[model samples]
Target: MGPIGGKSKLKEAAVGFALGAVGGCILGATEDPVDKIVSVMTTSGSLKPVMDEVRAVGALGLGTLIGATALTTAMTSVIAGVILAAVVASMFVAMRSCTGSHEHSVGLWASAGFAGAIGTTLSGASFGIVVELIVKNYGMVGLLWALSFFTVLKPPLRFVFKVLWKQGEICCTPGSEVRSREREHIEITDWQQRQRVTLQIEQRILSLEKGGSTSGIEGRTMWATQQKEREELERRKLENEEAEMAQRSIQDWINTVMVKHVDFLAFSGIPMAIVAIVTSGFGLFGYGGHQSVFLVLLALVGLLGYFLLKSSDFKFWMLVGCMGMFAIFVIGMLTLHAGQVVVTTAVKMRAAGRNLSREQISTAMNYQSSLEAVKTAFFGAKLCQLGLGATVGGALVRRSAGDVKVIAGAASVAGSLLAGLEVLAPALGDGGTAGALLGVVGATGVSVGATAATAGRWSSWPGTLGTIGGLLIGALGMGKWHIVNIGLQLPVAYVFAMINPF
Candidate 1:
């Protein structure tokens, strides 16, 4: 044959080769020999009719391609080929459906597309199964020929259904409008009005009978009962009014305290920053494996500095409480040094003879069984610290709000204790000890401070300072066994770098 002539024609040859290759692969990989043979024979015979139907449905371009390749066949039929074709076709249908009017009406284009794709794909598989069964009984060549003819007719059948569904006219009744109109026009307005009137008259008569019965009651007893009800309602109303007034007063007090505290912080920004730098620097440079302590202390110092600037508005005892919390933080840091020493010694003893992995060494030193435990302890401690900071800061800011200050103070103390427990519980395995101490300290301080602060009398600065000093000494006595360096290196460095910029 010439290059452009006979079976070697450019378009026909390419399409024929492709179809033949696909068919061959499908046949060779088919599950059953009989089914494969029959399927090919049926497809071959059905090609022409299928193409004709496809063309009639205005899919001539696609139909031509399918027609040209319809006769191509393979040695065997593969289940995969049928599955692949069905899936692709179903997906194409689903995409079309999504873009069509059905999806737009329901406002679920994506969901409909997904659902439709699955449904169609499954339907296609079912059709494939039917084709497989038919092909098993027939010959391969015959099935192939039949499928080619079937392709031409299938499109038209599918198109008819699509059109019918889109129009919603497939099973609808014709010329039913007259009946619908008659049904819509039917009315019983007069009867409904009469029924409503009858119900109203019945209700009125019942109410009159009840009233007449009540009027027959002894007048003195009825009068006393009415008076009692009136008094009760009046008392309840007064109580409600008093409660509302009290709540309003409390809210007003809180607002006033908040405004004063916020203003104080704003005014004392410079001094607060200085205090933060000093405290944070000391903690950072002096402590080993406790870098976070510096940051926490710095924040507290900054907050206190702000309070001092607005000392005129702050209650004396609130200042004392703030200072006391800071002292406790320092004490905790000092205590942690002893924990570190114990941890180091334990690790050393465990690894005395045998070679140990880095992970093992770390676990032994920390007295933690797993990395997960360490992570949990660290996270819990951080949460407790944050809670403590918030509580103390809120109390200082709202000290003038009576019992709120006490509550905040108590919460801060509890949070600190929880943080302590987070650290010690894992190492010591002691239950309730840490929690009990926290409750005792929190309750005592909160109750005392709340009572005094709510009394609306300010304590002297000397008295406030003395109380804080005493608390600091006590905490230090408890925690001073841990000796770690405490210095102001980081803050100093930061300040120097900022000023010099070198």
Candidate 2:
């Protein structure tokens, strides 16, 4: 035999190869998005179908690519942080003998944060150039093929890491091994003490059995107390052991699923996917003259989401629904205002004896709030910025002492400042990049806040309510003045990124 695990490795490879072949075949069979758009528009003689196809492709392809890029940016930022820490440590080594002196380590965190920000910014810029090059050369089909390949490779890679490579076994962070060893020692000592107590109790029971009627009333009472104490200790010990096992299992599962498979595109794509699905449902039902049926189906979905969602905490869903309702209200008001502005401007022009066309009025209403803006949001530069902001927000959450609310507040403030910078510059928000980036930051904050609120045994309803309330306040206040068009879909990605779907 080659090795004990050779057969399993071979089987894994075989499965991967089969899946990859199937995925490749499926991807290869699909037409390019551009080709599909051209064909659909030519046949239909309408922009509606073309826009729908574009939305589907944008969400599926560009969203995935942006997510992948964000992941790459996060990795780069981590590497940058490590390098900066090492440099700072070396500097401290020259100043102090121990190299880890508390006084000398004051700038370590600052240096790491600075390096991470700079590194991610540069990475984002480079990603834009790379994306432009890829599109120039391979087109959208390439993105499809790339995503398919990743999907196909994911399972085998997971198995290799979890099983063959045993990466999951080495789960401790720096200095955690020592703590783990200490815990084990304490547990061993406790077990030994329990055994001694058990032996003493058994001896006492034997003595009582041998001399049953000779004991006084006080002695029998003492024995009864001892028996109760022994039972309580054993019960407590068993509970502790069970709790430890459960904690370990939960942590392991989180590591395997959420940490390992952090896909931003999927996170961001979920909202887009939902929108697409709902829109498609409407179109299909309306086309077949079953508009009422579509409404019924939507209501059913709402009911299921309200009552039967077992995948995630129910409180989270409620918070998301509230946030969504607020967003819808904001969108409705904006649309109504935009319509008024368009009409008012058109009338003024007509009164001045210069009648404007419908196209001209529509153009004045701002393209940044349209589907075109959604398409533009996924532009390489903008997507990279949004991803970087989200990564930074998530890092802030990690650095806190599990106080997600404070970190989220800090992140939102930072994002607002970034968006404000665009306002001062004016060139940045002209493209809606500022809005998109700020949206991701705000979304990340809420996602982290929601996680902290509902993750533990007792739900922090106040925290959950506060986070949602803050989101609405920020959306209404900042969105109108600085970051226009902060959509609801992108936050879905941020939320899913933090919350484990499984």
Candidate 3:
């Protein structure tokens, strides 16, 4: 059984690793939005003639990516809050059972979720604002200093915030609290009645004793029963008090540690973005000294790991190590891909009996590279839309107790449609057109899946308002529709939340 359990745990770990890898790739592809947008615009017939449009688009993309990064951090925070709340809730329930208490007065989920939402929102907002005001305006100088700021200050800040902000407030739902109070009142009244009855039995026993009658024995029996009942009530009250104390301790500990973990994740994006910018800059320059960059990064990671090890912060170490390794891996892959693309283009030109001039080959490579950012942005937006739809579908399922089969069917159909549309991408003759088609299909899939999941929910006011709000925030306000940044920052956030790297 032990070996089997070990194997099962290993299998789960492998699955998680694979997910992390794929997610990292998706995020890495979307980094350096400003450069990518410029590249895409350079290739466009209309936008190429208008530099202002290109600059505006680039800024918009950058802002959107940053905001999406904030959203990803927020989501991870929510995940941490939910998981911590669940564990604490389970602990409290066990303690309650030991006290022979069956009352479900605790509304841990609502309180935890609310607190998490507020904290996460504030953290994201503050982080985003600081990055924009301080780091972004200075360009490369900003990136350099920002990197140092996050690496040095973030960990201590996480601890400080955890100590300062209580993530989990042990609050009951309003209705449940009212019900619990009423039950307590009834118990108090019953105890008072029991006390009165015991006093009456005592008086009767005394009277019987005075009368020197056999009825005194019956009165003694009644008095003994009343005493036993009173002792039982006293024992229950003591157990209740103990249970309450235990719950308070658990809540405090959870709030301290778990909230710190969330803060740690919430602040990770800035550093991740800085890393992406540095790597992407190297990519633009053909990375003549890429090895040096890798070595420097590895050394920094090692230094941090040493500190983490000294502190016995295994989780944080793991998160940092995982991120460092993946960044190296993805950077290596992109470098190889760029080389391969240049070689492939040259080979095709030669095969077609055309002279592969250095200038022509460079032009081709540059054009191809330029399209990457546009593709990444479009793909990122589509993914965010799909995720939003899935989230809504999941909620509807929970509320309606709906069949999972229908949702599954809708997703499968959407997947098939996406696969079919993929074949038409090259035929579109332009990378931007192909990417736009992908987004359209994704939006359509979201609509179909959401409606199929729960038509009633889709038609409701909450649903309508949510849809409009999402559109306005993701599309209109951002100049492109996206919720999560499909970039290096997201994977970092996820790993921190999942592994609790603090």
Candidate 4:
């Protein structure tokens, strides 16, 4: 849909605000240790000490391996970070894609879940093994392996998915397959582009009305369709046993993009930080020293957001820009806290007559907390972003309701404020307690009201309620007793993903 004629921007903003508040709650409920870990893994060093411990234990069995990964610097290099991110993202996509409504007892999408999980697990293991075998060196070997694996696996995975989906139609569900045709990638353009494209089409139609032979632009569109995409689509159909392939979903694309972005930020953070320092008058007035650094980083973040937007998809960019800022800020906070730890430890060592340097203390402390570092760096923003995206997605499902778009402007402001609170809640010392309450209650209330306000297939609200509870319970379990956040977060993400917001 074109941005101008659709729902008013106000309603959209309100939806985002509501979702952001829920996200704030999720952040508040989760342990701060997540942040602490991110601080430790900022460096480029390999996890030598952690690997040594792993090897000493003899074999990488499940329990021991899990503990080791949980306790160690499992992914310290850039390649390792990308690999780890990709594995989780791919697995997440698979898990969420399962449980679809096909004709069979089991659905095609659902059946493919295991294949995706297995593939991701093997990828994770291969990443670790390759890193270990290569001595965790920084080079193209790791990158090549990762790229090769991802590229090589797509066709087979698609084929498997097709087979499963076909069988699922026959075996699993009460009805025939129910695939949403809205699975295509969203493409929106500015008014100018829209008008130009319309003019082109209308002109061609006029020529056809006059019985003119198809020759110029009209022929090109037909020619290109025949020349490229049609053939490709047909081949893919043959391979996948389907009429079409869903374009990579927005959620999946963003997940994959962010990992690549982490690589960009790894190099960009320093130069950007330096610029912030100089521009802030050395923290004389602008943003509060560290905050100033992050503020400058936000500029870069926004730039990336603009690129990701890739066009005049204003609404998409707004949420994504905010998310980019959130990601950079979270990473920056970890780095700041790590600096404090290094200084504190060095000071303590000097007092104890050990005389350790700041560099050495920083390095040792970083090694000690590599687990959290990997967690925060690789996996943190993804969950929050997912939650936020899905929550705002409520408005999408309710778009057919009368006068809803008119509320988007006000909603945008509210959403922005809530988003601010979500991102800055940690600074208040209450771990975003207030924000969390608002998010949970607000999101719950919004979803309910939105469902009542609309008259279409808006069954997504019920699952969202469960998702809120999941966030709370999962965060509590993980924070209090060291339960895996994934146990809860994954299901929540699955719900988020399953909702065809468009």
Candidate 5:
């Protein structure tokens, strides 16, 4: 208060809110990695469970599919992301009152997210039907569907942000609305400061007329009080001007835009829809069954084509090279061992009175190789999820250790209760119903546990660890564990973290 701070109160609050928003996005985006979902689909070697609404949530599918994953993971992300985005948006709006048209309320974000969910779910189901009707197979057709989706949806959604949603005010720079607002803000503050001084003088006059205090306490006089009020007004007016001037620079624009572009969060639904569709289709069309060489080639073409169009980064080239080497390796193995593997595979099939086609035999062999690739993808996804979770969780823990601890404690209790109920009553096995419950228990539990652990808390570990044990034991008790097959190992590993770094 003695001297004007380098940064205004509003600017400091906006920066913290923006950073927190980023942390939230990171938390939501990576919690359930898309590639992990794909790898899970591929791991099963078949689609029976992947397509089932009940079984899909348990898929590495990352809640993109129609089943419990959507209800649990997807829903969690939506709520978490929106709440997080809203909190940041609210902070910005509250402090930088000139920012954007966004309402300073949680309901706005919740409503937008709700609308997005509706659109995504509808698109996912409809796209599946459309793809089935138009394409001979889920090869290039599915790829086209996904790309076209991004293209068609991205722009329109962005338009909504521009025209209807009225975002981007935070992005305003020298040539934009923010500058205009900043100038207006200065004028308003100047007027308000002068108004305060005027009001104080008026009050003093009224007090004198009413025979109020005059040098009655601590030897203070009306003149001294009037001068102090005038000085305070000048100080405030000066700080306001300095802040206004600083707001004109490029730095403020960058910071504001970073906070405001969250409007783009609207279109994330398109990707969610795509994930649901592709994951479900993969299971429905290509799981566990053998693929003809022609079909596999088409899939490869689709994958390569999509990558080339979608990304130009160095990572794209690295992906292409890696895929090329894997393809070559596969080809070499097939050329050498195809006969032997097919003979053995076909013999097993024949004993069950089924005749084998060379194509089906080839599909069987390829399935094994696909498993290896899927594992690599799964591992990568897990590592990324954990790292991002840790980073964000650490930040949250630092911000409010007590809140994170409470969250962790709540999650562990809920998870343990879930595990115990399922264990005691194996008959409660419902793929989606029970799986969703389990997913909620596990997802919420691990997410919070991650947060608390980053804060150096371990009290929640026992209950969280007990959750995995309870789920397995309960599912096994009723032989229902096999019904859900994203595999327990990864889910356990996902939240199985606790270490103290004093």
Candidate 6:
């Protein structure tokens, strides 16, 4: 029995590795690393482009790692991996012809796709091995190995894309040059018009000069008319020059502002996102016992990061960097939390109503069911948080005043706090009818009110009140009172609350 169990474990690990590699390859291809490298390189001439590419690669690598890790079931992992690879390979092939690179021919793309699949497969295999080793050792060494391998692989993958981009294996137009040429054309056309006017004025003057004079009074009048015409021509010429100057100045200002904004946003957002991720990571892993502290710290970091990124001047990479860091931090923290919940729940269940051996407790705590539940809850929370954040962020983005934006942010915070209370309050309460009833009422009321409030202005108090009343009547009992419970029991209700809110 022992030998058979060991064999099964090995088989599971092997399957996981194979699936992970396939999945990684597919996801990697979707990212179009080569195109991204080329874009950055063309726009920015320095190590900046390379660094940017590295960041993108790192994000994708981390995502791949997490995704592979989550697919614990061998069959599911394999299926997911194969599907991911096929989709990514197909996309790459489809886009290959669009680049207009004969050297990066259909054959070359096919070859690259095959290579990507192999690399991804290897990555997945490495992840599976690392995970298995970690499970066995349950030590810092295993964690370090995972992190180190990921860090090393990220740069090389990025470098490959960078090299391909440099070889002109991708194509993107130089927008600045295109705009400049367009402006030059407009200026040239204006200049031609001015020349034509000047020629017409000269022809009129020559015609007047060639005509013979009949009388002194008539000649004097003709002289006065010519003088007026000359003055008018001079005024028109001055107006044309002023218009041209104004147009040039406006164009120059626009170009300068655009460049400045892009640079500022990039600089500000990238650093802010990185800081948020690092801080969140430290809070999660460093102060494990004080989870509330970590959660608060993480939230603050995210809020600060959002503001810092938003206040930036609109640089493309700044936004990219910010998003990249955000994704990394969120996914990492969530994964850690999920793992903790799983381990804790398992231990609690195994040691239920007993003073069991530490080893027994530990072994029981690592049970698959607990881990799966924790993982699901963690991801579900993340998805909810992200969706809510996006909605609030989108709303605030439209507001020009910082004060108004702050109000929107406050609403988001309030909503999150309410949701947290709904989840945590029930856990704290004793398992009794009264406690359960109170939790149900409180959660239903808060969820309804908050959902309505988030949808629009505070003036919708009537609608908010109606929603709460409806939830209380329809979902307060029958084991369907919890927000999550409601979400599962009545998906339409949940969606309506999210969208309409009334």
Best of the candidates, TM-score: 3
Error of 2 at 492 (Å): 4.9
- Per model, state how many residue pairs clash: 58, 2, 3, 30, 6, 7
Which wins on lDDT, candidate 3 or candidate 5?
3
lDDT of 4 by residue, 1-502 (tens): 6675334444444444344334333333333533443333333444443323221211111111222221111111222322333444334333333332122212232222223223322333343444334324532223223323443453354455446544643453221122222122112223334465578679879988999867678678765754465455445334333311321342334244443333332322222222222322322332333444455555754665555456564343234334433443454455345445667877887889989765676455544433333444345333433343333334433433222331232233234444544565455322122223223322222232233233223234433443344344433553464446545444444354334322
Model 6, TM vs. native: 0.31
Candidate lDDT scores, in order, read 0.32, 0.37, 0.40, 0.37, 0.37, 0.35
Q: How do the residues 329-366 of candidate 3 rate in per-residue lDDT, one tens digit apiece?
A: 34333433543487697998799997788876655544
> 118-214, model 1: which lDDT tens digit per residue?
3322332233344434434542223334544543443354455345433442233221232233233332433444466568557657978888433
- Tell how far residue 58 is off in model 1, in angstroms: 89
Candidate 2, residue 501: how far the Cα is off, in Å: 0.8
Reference-based lDDT, residue 221, model 2? 86
TM agreement with the true structure for every prediction: 0.23, 0.36, 0.44, 0.34, 0.37, 0.31
Task: Write the residue-wise lDDT of candidate 5 on 1-502 in tens digits.
Answer: 6344433443433433333222222223322333334543454433222222212121222122222112222222322333343334433443453332233233333333233223322332333334323322443234335434543554455455445323444442233344456566666766776787678778878989999975556335655766676677566556545554443332333233333333323332333344334443454454412334325434544564465446654332233223332333233233224334556879988999999887776555444433432333233323322322332333334433243342344344334444444453333322222222322333333343343343233234343333334333433333333433324332432333332111
Give lDDT tens digits, candidate 2, residues 1-502: 6784666555444433332222222111111221232233223223232223323233222222333332333333323332333334333222322212222233433443344333333343344345434434554344334434444554455454345224423533322343345456657766776786688668778888998544578668866876776676566556545544533443343343333333322222232223323333343333312345335434544653454345464443233333332232233233334435667878988999999988766544432122222243333222233333343334334434233342333343334434443454234322123222333333233333333322221234333444444444444443342223334323442554354322
As a whole number from 0 to 100, the lDDT of residue 194 in candidate 6 is: 66
User: What's model 5's TM-score?
Assistant: 0.37
Q: State, as a TM-score between 0 and 1, how close model 1 is to the true structure.
A: 0.23
Mark the regions of model 6 whose C-alpha exceeds 4 Å error after superposition: 1-144, 148-171, 212-362, 368-377, 380-482, 485-502
